[model samples]
Target: MKSISKYWSIFQITLINSLAYPGELVGRSLMIIPFMWIFYQLWKVTFSAAGAADGMINGLTLRDTLWYLMLAETIELGRPPIARTMSENVKDGSIAYILNKPYDFLLYQFSTAMGETIFRAMLNAVFGGLTVWWLVGTPNHPEGFLIALPAIFGAWILHFSINAMIGLSAFVVEDVSAFTWIYQKLAFIFGGMLIPLDFYPQWLQNIAKLLPFSSAIYGPARLFVTPTLELFISVMSLQITWIIALTFALAIVYRRGLAQLTVNGG
Candidate 1:
């Protein structure tokens, strides 16, 4: 009870703080507008070129693909710079202050992120829905909203942990931009950000399925469009498993990182 309350306070504080900087959320969502437009045109051209080859490229029409793209964009944009901030804190010794706090530093981070993510997700859905309506008039599968909720939450957990792990790497490497960049690209490519993983070669699909990247953006967004009981269970299960494993991995990393910290002046 106390723990929940304590984190609840952090969550509330972060939520209010986000309002102070309303532009960030709006700006981030707005920035995706142009990109979404570009994708719309590109996909339209591609589908036109495909021209009766098949309406389903890896179980996606032009419309379904656009919907999937919106979800993917939202997830990617909604992520706060957990890795960047943590890496900078570690580099500058500011993590000392965070460590001195009563709550777990990672939990504190997660709570703050959750607040921001909730706000962003709501706004992103609105903006994305508008954008999709403008371009393609209802991207299909309205029922997916329900099926995707748990999967998206699970993806958020996995994303947070993966980023925390990258941030913790700063303890040894001191700079993690390269790592983050690579991770983002891999998530974009293998995670099915640009397109569906099913369109990829069988070998690539196998590799992507094995990685958490697939579970995060790809799997959840895929769930939003596909929405089958079996697929939902499979995606959610993968997301849950990745959440547990990545969180366990983060615990180990944070433990070691804490041990390595140098605390002196009171």
Candidate 2:
């Protein structure tokens, strides 16, 4: 318990340090704005052209698509750059010191990442959601909101686990940056960041359902516009399954890596 508290305190200190750099913080926050604007405009144009035919594109209304875009932005904000964090620690040899500590390094990173993720989520909910909502009314539906709660929470857990697995790769590879970049691009592309999964071809959509990336964005975005009990169960179940699988895999990697780590002076 004391060890947990100490690691959490360290995480809080890191969070405060992040908040102190106002310029960097604002700049990072603003980076998502243009992407949001582009997607919003593209969706608006598509809906305008489709008119009543928009339903052909997955039975989605213009408003539903807009809400999907908004939800995607929010999810992106909540995602932690765990790959980068692990790569940095490994490169700087800080991971050695972390391993020597009496605390669990994985838990320490997870807690810190969660803190940053929550903070970013709040900022995006206010600034990102507000900017879009003001221009286009809030995408609110009582049923959607009710269903979204569980979906979003499940998505966060699944996302964190996926990232933890990626971070674990740092133990094997000297440069995980390239892998991280490719993984993120694939996540955004197939995870429904640019467009809803329903917009994808049937075969692609089926494949995506089996992957963890879809739970991160597509599952929750769909919840906002199409509330179904089955969808909720499926999304939550997949997330839980992936979390367990990834955690087990990471445990193996950690044990093996620790055994192999060579200490010169100790």
Candidate 3:
């Protein structure tokens, strides 16, 4: 463990590698174009049928909902497949080399993930924004975006920590596929991916907010579309809290997993 700079360099390398396939990155980002249209039609039809007083549903205008989805997918689509990566490393004895390195293995893993994630996340966010512009024009909540900046950064940290926890669980579970799938569903339903939390029943919304899933995905998107200073403070505070808690939990899991490692020595 030399210093933070060492792992930061690893982060830089990972970021550079992600840019190696700029075309592929742009292509993958196009996935959001259709996503925006589908949701746009769905909301448009739903709102037309709802025929509410002001084209609003459950406290959100259709425009607000679409932007929420855009922000959510920006974070969601950028996620790396770390569970399999971690499992492969553990199975192939690569974990041994990683643990012996000067920089902290956990820090190195997180740095690399963040580095690569920034590339993908930036692309996804830009594409998603463009889709929003083409479909709905400028964001209705411009002020909300200013507050969302810190919230989005916090959410990214929380997102990485949650995935890192799943990956590090390779020590306890041979496979993390089931866990990741279940978590993804939770994120879709509770993290307000498929829809915003406001659409949910009051009790269900409470449960969603209580989970880290919401803090990771919904918190940032929610802050961007709904701009109350109180809410901005609340979501950012919760995101920071979850980031600390999840990072600590990941450290504990890694320490235990490292201690459990056995060598085949004469």
Candidate 4:
């Protein structure tokens, strides 16, 4: 209990620190507005072009599609750059100081990452939701937000696990920019950030759903639009599976990285 409180304190401190620059936080979140606008325009055209007699394409209406995208953007943009930050810490030798602290490094990073993610995600949801509302009205299942909340948290955990693994590579190679870049592109495509996985061909959808990326972005966002109890269970189940798998993978990487870690600061 006492040890848990320590990480809780770290989370609380970082959460407060993130708000120390209110203007910057809000400004960064504001970028979601333009992203939502562009998505609305792009999808509106695609929907029109499809011209489904029932006004549905791939099991989603335009409004559903827009709302889905807003949530997806919120999740993606809300996350802090954990891999990059870790890489930088390694390069600068600040990681040595962090290691001296009496806390598990992985848990400490998780606490800080979640602390940074909370307000950014909320702000993005607010700004993006408003923009999407103006463009497409309210979501089909407004209650879905509450239902999807747990999955959203799970999504972040899954994201952290994967990213921390990439960051751990910093112990071997100082620059992980290439790795992060590839990860981002894979997420954009397989996680359904730009287009919902339902819109993909059947074979592609199957492939994407099998990947961990879908659990991070598509699962929660899709549940937000549909919001069925069964879907919630499926999403959470898959997310938890990935979270467990990736977390174990991350622990292995962290241990190996720590072995290779060499800090040279007197």
Q: All models: lDDT? A: 0.86, 0.73, 0.83, 0.93
Best by lDDT: 4
Residue 187, model 1: Cα distance from true site in angstroms: 0.5
Task: Give the local distance difference test score of model 3.
Answer: 0.83
User: What digit string (tens of lDDT, one per residue) describes model 4 on residues 191-218?
Assistant: 9999899999999999999899999999
Rank order by lDDT, top first?
A: 4, 1, 3, 2
The true-versus-predicted C-alpha distance at residue 229 of model 1, in Å, is: 0.3
Backbone atom clashes (below 3 Å) for every candidate? 0, 0, 1, 0
**TM-score ranking of the models:** 4, 1, 3, 2
- Candidate 1 weakest lDDT stretch, 10 residues: 257-266
Compared with the true structure, what per-residue lDDT tens digits does model 3 show for residues 1-266? 45867877898999999989899988998998899889999988888898999889898888888898999999888877766677667767687777777777877887877787887888888888888888878888878877888888787778777777787677777578888898889889989998898888899988889888899889989889988889988998888888889999988887777765663211
Tell me how far candidate 4 lies from the true structure as C-alpha RMSD in angstroms: 1.2
Clashing pairs in 1: none
Candidate 3 at 59: error in angstroms? 1.9
What TM-score against the true fold does each predicted structure earn?
A: 0.95, 0.87, 0.94, 0.98
Q: What is the lDDT of residue 68 in candidate 4?
A: 93
Give the CA lDDT, 0 to 100, for residue 180 in model 2.
Answer: 78
